[model samples]
Target: MHTCLAFFIIGFLVSTTNGFYSSSDDVIELDSSNFDRLVMQSSDLWFVEFYAPWCGHCQNLAPEWKRVATALKGSVKIGAVDADTHKSLGQQYGISGFPTIKIFGSNKRSPTNYQGGRTADAIVEQALSQLRTIANERLGKRTGGSSGGSSSSGSGEKDTIELTDSNFDSIVIDSEDMWLVEFMAPWCGHCKNLAPEWARAATELKGKVKLGVVDATVHTQLAQRYGVQGFPTIKFFPSGRKDGQAEEYDGGRTSSDIVAWALDKFQANVPAPDVLEITNQAILDDNCAEKQLCIISFLPNILDCQSACRNEHLTMLKNFAENYKRNRWGWLWVEAFRQQKLEDSVGIGGFGYPAQVAINARKGKYVVLKGAFSQMGISSFLKELSAGRLTSPLVPLNGVAEGKLPTIIDSEPWDGQDGTLDIVEDIDLSDINLDDDDSDKMKKVINYRCPKFFQNNFTLSMQSLSVYARLFARAISSTEAEHILFNGLLRLSSSSVHATQSSNSLAITYPSTAIKHAVHLVTVSSGYSSHDNNEYECITKTKRRNSLIEQKPHPSNVYGDDAFFITKHRLGDFLGVADGVGGWREHGIDPSLFSRSLMDACKSLIDNKLIDLNPLTLKELLSKGYKQLLEDKQCIIGSSTACIVALHNEERILHTANLGDSGFVVIRKNTIVHRSQEQQHYFNSPFQLAIHPTIKDPRLIADSPDLASVTSFDVEENDFIVIATDGLWDNLPDATILEEIKQIKVS
Candidate 1:
């Protein structure tokens, strides 16, 4: 019996030792011996799969595999390996999972994993896409589609217009379309390399902006006209401008970079949304129903405030609408009492006329404006709304929860002229005080509300008061007028107080005054949190001087191979975390050195104030930090995933930039409202900026810092932000993290 079993096992091994695939199928069966010589060294493109013979998924995918192999018979080589029989080959390629497919392009040493669908159609589509990418990379040798850079004429790049000296003015200057023109020399290698990317960008921006190219060597006149000092000189000609200097394109040369820059220009060219009056149901439906956020203001009746006052309000709204045009919010207005149902539905009357509310029409929720109605007030309100920091709950719109807008009564649009009253009786204000004493009283009121630093300078001139009266001269009651002016003064005074106190704490006298005016003008539009209130108490003279003195700060927390750093300055706190890539261990490099070096470089930037701390400048900070890492004398030779968050102290806004799998999540009221998205090229392979021994090495994955995901958010006290690496995130789910936070708070 033992002899019979041994013979049966030997027969089974002899039968299927080379794996499931055979000569009958189109699939090229591979083993440990021929992997390097056949696929690695081959010049042709290859799609290879490492599979286990006993795997059910491999068996299920066998038919589709054969179909894919048949489809790309000559174009791409399809092959398979049995990992169960050849463990060395599987270990060599780091194939931990069964039926893993990899695409071998020009860089066979670092083959990319195939992430397309399992079906033959999806595989073929992805295979062709890869082939096109490889072809585009080798486009330097090709002579078609503007790649040659020898003439203005080209095939295959229809979207990319051919611009020469003869037609440059007629097509580029005269036309209303925004044009991005590239001036290149025929023999320039950089121009050749940028050809495919330029063509791709042109194709993507087909209907939006026109992209053109000129051979600087051929069109010497046009080149000198634009002062093309270098090859591949890029110039941007904006729409509707015939004379002004063409702006130099200093942005990245990648296709995505070009598209992003063009899109920004396109959006800037778009006119602000028309501030329409909701006169009827159709108008309301057209403006509000489909919008992400609808901003509706109920101004006082024309009789209450004449054309001058109404127009002033409308102009303010228009300016805000223009500033926030990128959000694509619908801006509409309605006269109070004209749209009684709409006003009541949004609870606008309780606040008084000239009230405003931002409604999320899709969610049937609205947030009433809590700040003043002037430029400062409205600006603050909108900023708060934009930051998602408005504390007011989104009250459900009346009847909107039932999928219906409030009933609107048909009415005529406002006429440019002021409405006349039935009783045309005139009144005189001869007894009212418009003298120095009144101005002094106003100054006293402002001084009382403002801090001691601004008390001496808090003076209200009669001319300023006269201007204010002229702007707001309306046929309204004295009580209402006083209410408006008093509210504005209080708001301005409160901001001044906050700014002075904050500046004192940081020992910044000059900047505090500027911050005060800026805060009052372009307000962050949120009240002080408990944390802010506590910080204000630290504004004593001794403490201020102490804070100004240089002192070494402690480093932030670290876990395993990850390093974190936090530093505070006059602007705000800089918090950052970097996760070292462990794969460098195989190459005899310490991964922790890379991440720690990166975090330390970032801390140095913050400490030395090498980079400006702003909500939108986090990407710049990352760029500077990454550059510092590259310029380090020690020569860090590993990769890391990074996440940095900058808190603009006074504004209470969090500016963040994340690269790779390390990320941060913002929890407001115990609910995650915002989080950083992981940047990954493929599954488990994150998008990282690397420093290899050889610069621009094809074997290493080195993404640009520009590709880091940069974003900003307004934060309040009690908002917990968890910044961590993939280790913590992969091991713990969001629910578990939140629960742990709750437990920590409870304890």
Candidate 2:
């Protein structure tokens, strides 16, 4: 009996997999030339992996591929094509790499190419995900557009349809009624998984909707023509239209969502029920003795009011009637414009053609809605009537008497700082205290918000700056600060002024103080000027300082050429400067690179394992980093320099290295203490070793034996460290920098 059952299963598989392809336990092989025809005819989801036998990755993935194919054998059709043997077929699908998979679904014309890394598990996962989406879509269709619903089906032989780009139009568009087309690629893991679910849906919807598949690889032109940007893009097309030309509806990648959407659209196209129309007087005459709530539609012409006579409008009326039909609340509709008696009964002033509705049987009690009303809008009107606030015309409140206010005891206590107090009581007009701080006084006032202060300050500042700029006006470049101040002021107030009281006040206040302080600083400082005479002198001085600093040489005392040392202590840490590759002379290169590099490198060293008391490891790590920098591409064209130290407790260590120009110093007990001489030749001339063209060479890894000796030192805790790039070192004396650091610390 078991042997007979096995024979029966084999026979069933053989009978099902007939035609141009032959199915085995491992794979379904297709003739290269007839691949398109075979794929186009098959209804099941098809996944074909195009691979080169010689490819190592493909050979390694063969077993896993076979396992996946067997697992999805009954549900999906999996096949492999040897690209080397079928070069033309491979080229058709743009198979430039081996182990490329593509998927073909019922409504798809061509396969989509998978772009991620090729792996057996990745491919299987992708295929399964796609399949689930297609399954959900099919289930949605069978369930009458309702989500999470099931459908009854017959037990019958599974059905299949072959689809391709060439005949996709005939299968999807020109044929029967609704067609759901899935655009997919075999190489795509997503497409592969979608294949099984797509096949199941096709089988379920066999006679209802014509299903087809397109091999995206073999039909590149078709996929591109349809604007198939991504794989597993499924679209629904009504009968008698091409897939792309059909009204496009976005049914997210899920198959169930697509089916639900298709059902909804189809249902919408279904014919609506007929509407019943009656004269305006007929509605008024049939009213009850009690005040009846009526929905009166007014129109200037009978022909123009035909839309109101349609079932769509009647459906809305019927729905309203369902809730109020018992006359417990009373509901009726009248064509007020057509009937003179009804018109006189309701005071509708305009030619309300379309869907105008009014409530209340009495003329003056009605509310005229002069446009089409949606179901929700009509329902809302009915609800308002029930609430005793019928659709009455809006009346201006300008002359309305103010309502009485509660007694003072009933109300909350009046807080002095509350903004509402300003509305209740006017500000004291006689009090003018100019001596008080404006910001502090403003903060104390009622309705005084922070934003208002910012605005007030900004406005006052702009007024002052405008006067200053005109009085001390000079060339365009010199007025940069003024320009910045003006632009900043404009940015604050460009929005609608006074729209927001708090914002308006802020825009005018804070900037005013900032501008005043800036103007005062610029006016008082002798060094700052807008005149050409001072500007030229300033430029010259700056250029001279930069040149002098740029010419200074690296100290030879430091162990590694490009190294930064930071000494941490309780009082404050000492920072060392190390100028690395690239020089100040390079026009486009950043001169501050040395400063930034030293800070970053030292920060990393400190943050990592280097800050501990392991002196040997710290030194070794520092040396290794310097050597690595020399070998780096960036440092090849330039040299490096370093200065390191920190003062805390009663001890300190200061160390720095230099390659070109730049140095550092130490200040202990308020005395001038210089640790290393600036590597230079005489006063202005360059040093022999520094001037040498090979000084910046990457080959110069060892310490320079020709220069002045390298230096290092230990210092007291009270010592101050002054490390500077050439810009600061060359222009200012050591004592000056020490004093500056001390002042900065003190301040």
Residues 1-747 of candidate 2 have per-residue lDDT tens digits of: 999999999998866533222355456765576687778777667778787655555666667677777777677777878776788888887775566777765444545544334565676676775675556556643322111111112231134354676776656666656776666666775565555445555564655664455556667777787777877666667754344575554543334334334544444433332222333333343442234544544322322223433445556666666655433433443332333434433333222233444434333244544223656556665665543344455222222222211111112221222121112123331243322344233223322212222234444332222222221221122344333322332222221111112211111111012112111000110010112123354355335434444455232211111223333433334344444433433322222233234334454565454543322332343454444444443332233444343322233443334333445555555555764555432112222111112234333333331242344455544444444434333223333233333432210
Give per-residue CA lDDT, model 1, range 1-747, as digits (tens). Answer: 999999999998978743667799889988878988999989878899888766655766788999999999989899998887889998987786667887777767766567558899999997886677667667634434444653323442777877898999999999888989999887888887777668877878888888998988888999999899998899999988678379998655645456766887887888899999998899888888898788999887665566887999999999999998876899999887687788778865522456789988777788887655678878877876664546566789875446678899999888788765332122222333444444444443333222221222234222222212212211121344433433343223222223222211110101112123221100011111112223234234224323322442222211124556656677766667777775655454545556766776777777886446665577777788889888863456678888887767678577899998788887666667787877765335677878876433354678888999989877765565666666444433344345434432310
lDDT of each: 0.66, 0.42
Per-prediction tally of clashes: 0, 73
Q: Give the clashing pairs for model 1.
A: none
lDDT of 1 at 467: 19
Using lDDT as the measure, which candidate wins? Answer: 1
